[model samples]
Every structure is written in C-alpha cells, then in structure tokens.
Target: MKSLNSDAFRMSIAWSRIFPHGRKEKGVSQAGVQFYHDLIDELLRNGIIPFVTVFHWDTPQALEDEYGGFLSERIVKDFREYAEFVFEEYGGKVKNWVTLNEPWVFAHAGYDVGKKAPGRCSSYVDKECPDGRSGYEAYLVSHNLLNAHAEAYEALKKCEKCIGSKVGIAHSPAWFEPHDFKDAADGASVDRALDFMMGWHLETTMKGDYPAIMKEIVGPRLPQFTQKQKEKLKNSADFVGINYYSSVFSNHVEKPDPSKPMFKQDSLITWEGKNVDDISIGSQPVTAALPVYARGFRKLLKHIKDKYNNPEIMIMENGYGEHFGNKDSVAVGTADHNRKYYLQRHLLAMHEAICIDKVNVTGYFVWSLLDNFEWQNGYKHRFGLYYIDFNDNLKRHEKESGKYYKEFLSQGVRPSAIKRDEL
Candidate 1:
C-alpha cells in the first residue's frame, strides 16, 4: 500500500454492511459504522486520502424485497438518504465519494444475464421470461439506479464542511474488438457494444439523460425522467471513475424483429457465430474472456478523453486474476505468471494515457488490496496481487506480484522489474 501511495487513495462503503437491509429506513448497523470508523482512522493515520464508494454491489436483499431494489423509482430518495448519512458521518474526514460501483454489471450481467447475485436468467431461446421478468424489467431497474445515483450526487452538494469532497459514479466500461475488420457492419457492432456497456451511465452523468437509444429500444417499458430530474443530473459527477477489463470482438448476426428494443436493429452476430438477439450472447464463444489487450486500454482512454471531454480519469478497478487453484502457496508460482505480465502491460498502457494522450489520468488502483469474495466466481479467479487462502478465513499472503508491486513503485517501473520473479 505504501509503494503505490499517491496524493489520493480510494475506498468504498460495502452497502450490505451498512444497510444490511438495503433500505435507508430499515436498518443501519452500528457494527458496520464502527468497521468504517476503524478503517477511516487507519487510512488517515497512513496519510492516505480515503475516497469512498457508497454502494459496491453488496446491496442488502431487504431493498430488493421492499421495492425490487434499484428496479423501483423509490430507490432514488433511498440511496440519496444513504449517501447523506455517510457524508454526515464521515465527510469531515472522508471527502471523495462515489455513488455506486459498476452499474453496468448491476443491470446487465446481474439482472439480465443472471451471472452474479440477485440472479436473472433470461435466454432469447424461449423468451417466455424463464425467470418471469422481461429484459425490459432489468433495463427499468437500471433506469431507476441511474436516477438514484444522480440524487446521491445532489445530496452531497449541500454538505458545507466537506467542501473539497465530491461525489461521482463509478462505471465499468467493457471494450470490444471487431470480429471482421474488413466488414463495416462488424465494426459497427463493436461500437454498439461500447454503447450498451458504458453509454448507459455516461449518458446520465454527462448528458443529463439516459441513452436515447434505450428509450426507443425499451419503449414504454423504459422509465420516465422528470424535467427537474434531468436538470439535476446535469454535471452530476465531478469526475468519472472507470473500471475496465478485457476487450471482446463483435460480429454481425441477424435476428427477427421484436416489439421491444435490443442491441441489433438489423440483428448482427458477435464473432462467435451466435445470433445477436440471443440472450445467451455473453455465454457464446464470441464473448470469451479477453487476454489483456493493452491497446484497447489506450483506445478506451482516447475515446473517453475525446468523447467525454476528458473528465478526470481515475481507474476504479483494473487487474487480472489467475486460477491455479492452490491455496497455502507463496511467491511467483508458475500459475500466476500471466497476472504479473497483465499488470506490466496495462501499466505501460496507463503510462501511454498520461504521457502520450495527455488525458488527465489521475490514479491507478490495481483491483484490490487483497483478494476477497469475487461474487459468483467466488475465489476461483484470484485477481489480488496478494493471494488469500479462503480456508484460512481469507488469510492474505503477498504473492510475487505484491512484492514486485512494492519494489516497482519504490524504484519505478523498470523492464528488469516488469517480471517480478526475475527481479
């Protein structure tokens, strides 16, 4: 932690611990507050600035019961209240705040694909709502989530003592590569992937509205934003937090026309030869895991820089995970060499952003201080620079990557230091 320490460090409020019920009025655990109190004191003691994320996907199931979680329009006021509570409690010490972490995952993968918690499993195969909820419903939930984020931003504006503190939303924008470079249609498919992935939240933050395409696609099912609400969304974030991973390739696939809107107007397939309209697209071979594409990192930075008018960029999450599956292990094992390599390439790419692009790049946090519960994938994909033995009650052991990180930061990025084992 000391090696990478810059002028700023970001932290988050695990929503589940705070509002174990996911409702503002339901319950606020004193234990949870104390946990943060201890955490904040530690960070301050270390001279590390704490930037807090209010919700990081651990929403209390209670909120889901009350009004379908973010699906309900009521979530706006509720989330705003939660933000205010945190601000009042810790704003004197903790200033930088992020309203939510990765709304795209919350909406698309969590609710739509049903991969993570609060699962939704809908396939285009039957379209009978296998889970009894429409794609439109997930989108609606996301619509509510965006509004809730905006409200939280507005609430922080009133806190006078926390003047330097600011609130913003953290967005995970996935990038795509074109499956067939020769085909114009295929290239357009790649851009559309960015549209659905990052565009949803960026629209709310910068444009003061939801995606225009979502309105026509989701149609009446899409939620309405009041004019006053629109006005408030303007400049909702002082900065945009980005969590990016690997990039995928998009291919064209034709599909039948639907009453509700979807990604494909003409039905294009992703590179794997699956239909674009299939709800199983992500599961398709075309949607396979990305090998750390560093150039994609550069392109994504340029896109956000030129398109988003170069908002201050702080990488909220960017790291690799390896699955050798051996616990009680130590430094630079053969299994995690890829993760070490992934870190070097991505950091060089980040250097490109700061040096070449001049894109106002601020900070780079490598995913986590330690490996923790990675949702459904569980402990299978170890993203941490430090390895955690889950059987040991999540005991953290610094990997070669971790030591390399400390030295790399202490000395500076060096080619000889790029691969830690060799160093």
Candidate 2:
C-alpha cells in the first residue's frame, strides 16, 4: 500500500474468529483480538488509515444453529453483544467503522435466492435449499439485520474509547435505468427498483422506515419497526458507504404472478443488461455478471446527494473482476488493461461527481489490494490489483492496474489532456 501511495485500507472482522460461539460469554479468542491489534498498528505505522468493518456476513455456526442466524430476532441481541465487544476492544484505535456490509445482499441472496451461505429458500425457488419462505425470509432477515445495525450503532456511541470514531453500513446498490426510456411504466419501475434495492436499507437508516413503495407491494411480509426502534434507527449512520460496480436496465413487469412470489419479483421489475432497442448499457467485460457502466456511478452519487439530504459518502468497494480458469498465467494476468481501464473510468466518474456535482464524497477504497478467495467463486474470479500466483508459493505480482493506480495516486489526478470518454 505504501508503494502504491494508498492511504486507507478497508477490511472486515470475522465474527467466528473472535468468538467461536458468536457470544462473548462463551469464549473470546485472545489470539484473534491480538491479530487485529497488530494489523491496525501496522497500518498506522505505514501511514495508512484503517477502515474496519465489524461484520461482513460471517455469522458463527453456533448462532445459526441456535436461532437460524439473522432469520430470527434473537440474533439481534447476540449481534449487539458481539458488536459491543468489538467496539470496546478496538474502538480507541480504529475510527472509521462499518457496522454491517451489504445487509440487503446477505438477506436476499442467502434467504430468497439461496445461493450464498446458510442457503435457505422455498423449494420452488431452489429445491436444494434446506427450508425457507422465498419472499418472507428475506424481509425478516433484513428486519433483524437493520435492528442489529441500530443496536450496534447505539453501542458504539456509548463506548468511551470510540469518541471521535464514525460508523455506517456498506450498501451495494446498482444504479438502475428504465429499459425503455419512452415507456412511462418502465420509468416508474426504475424508481421501484431503486427503492427495493438501495432504499430498503438506506431509507431505513436515514428516516427510520422502509420505502413506502415497498410497504405497498410487500405488505405484511415486510416487518414493522416499533417507535423506539424507529428512533434508534433514524440517522444511525455517520456516513453512507457505497459498494458500486455496475448498472442494469429495469424493465417494468405489468403483472407479476402473485402465485410465485420471491424477493426479486416483489418490485414488479426485471433487470436487463441491454435496453428494449438492443443497446447495451455499457461495455460487458469478460465477467458476464458485472457490466462496465461508470456513468452509473456518477448518477447514483448524484441521486443520493439529492434524495437523502446529501450525506457524507464513501465508495467502500468498487473493482473489476476477471474470470481465468486453468489457462491463467502471470503474463496474461499481469497485463490487465481492462481492469486498469475500468478503474480509470470509475475514478473519472467519481471525480465529476465530487467536483462538479458537489456530492459530499469523502473516501474511495478499491475492493482489494491482493487476490483472495471470493466466496462461492473461490479463486476463479480475480478482482485484485496484485495477481496471486497460487501454484508458486503464493507469489504476488503487481498487475498493470496496480501500476496505473500507483501512478494516478502519485500524480493526484490523470493528465489534463485526457478526456472522460477517451479512457
């Protein structure tokens, strides 16, 4: 990081690593606590600010077995206890903290789609899932997650060591545009899509309630917050953390079948990479899932600025991922021109948002500094600036993107001759 001129590093703490049973009363791992203390000290010694994430979807199996994890309300109290332990432990050292990272993805992907950890979904949604209500469990999990965040925020406030520290949740929201700009229904669907994806959690933290559109559509399945909980939740975040990667077109679904209900279908919209006229939103890189759409980053930032009273914002995670199977080689991975280009475009977009649009943007951290295991994909999808050679004693080779980032940071900006579209 010092070689690259990087000033800040964002990392997450594994809940299971600290307390094996997800409760401090069970047992605390002194080794795990010391490990982070050393890490924070090392970063500070190297002139790097540490932005620590309290929870990043690593729920302890003990809690999962006891109360089905985030699915049950009981996890909220456990989460509060666990978070308090962390705040009390590292509060004096780490100032920037993220209470939760992408709660929406944890709830929707794990419970509704059943593709992530502790996979649970209705048999109709995914027959492999152990047991879950497709549309129902996601909302319930999100409710508990939100409540947990509020409780953690309250805990942070009370910690004497956490005086000048700041805390927030890192939200991963994709910017959505209408598939058909000419269609009024499609335009309306865009709002609903944003409301369901980002507003579900963002609005709750800002205003202490779910989006009105969500309540109208999901109805009773969406849990309600008590008056005390609402007060605790309102303005809980010190800043808004965004994890932007790509954008998609939202096509309006005139009539979603009520018989087959799921969280994805609740918004009555379908996502498309291309519009109705067969125009791609942006360049689709080798990774099929994430399309390159830098403009979306600027638009999303402006939307947040205008909609949510212009809260301080931080780009928590944004990077390009490439898939390289057995054919991977140092030569091929090191010459990552596409990843470099992706970073350049997004950085330019962020610049425009901050300087021109006056978005209260503060910090921007890349998704990763080194190639590491990516959840379900393992080591197949690489999103790191430094290529990790798994076959050769875990050697690290700085890629073209890393070099470009170093140059960009050293110079503090790209050349004035370079235009936004030129990249």
C-alpha local distance difference test of each model: 0.69, 0.89
Error of 1 at 192 (Å): 2.2
List residue ranges in candidate 2 displaced over 4 A. Answer: 1-6, 287-289, 415-417
TM-score for each candidate, following the candidate numbering: 0.86, 0.97
Clash list (residue pairs), candidate 1: 217-261, 251-269, 252-268, 252-269, 253-267, 253-268, 253-269, 254-267
Best by TM-score: 2
State, as a TM-score between 0 and 1, how close model 2 is to the true structure. Answer: 0.97
Clashes of 1: 8
- The positional error of residue 403 in candidate 2, measured at the CA in angstroms, is 0.3
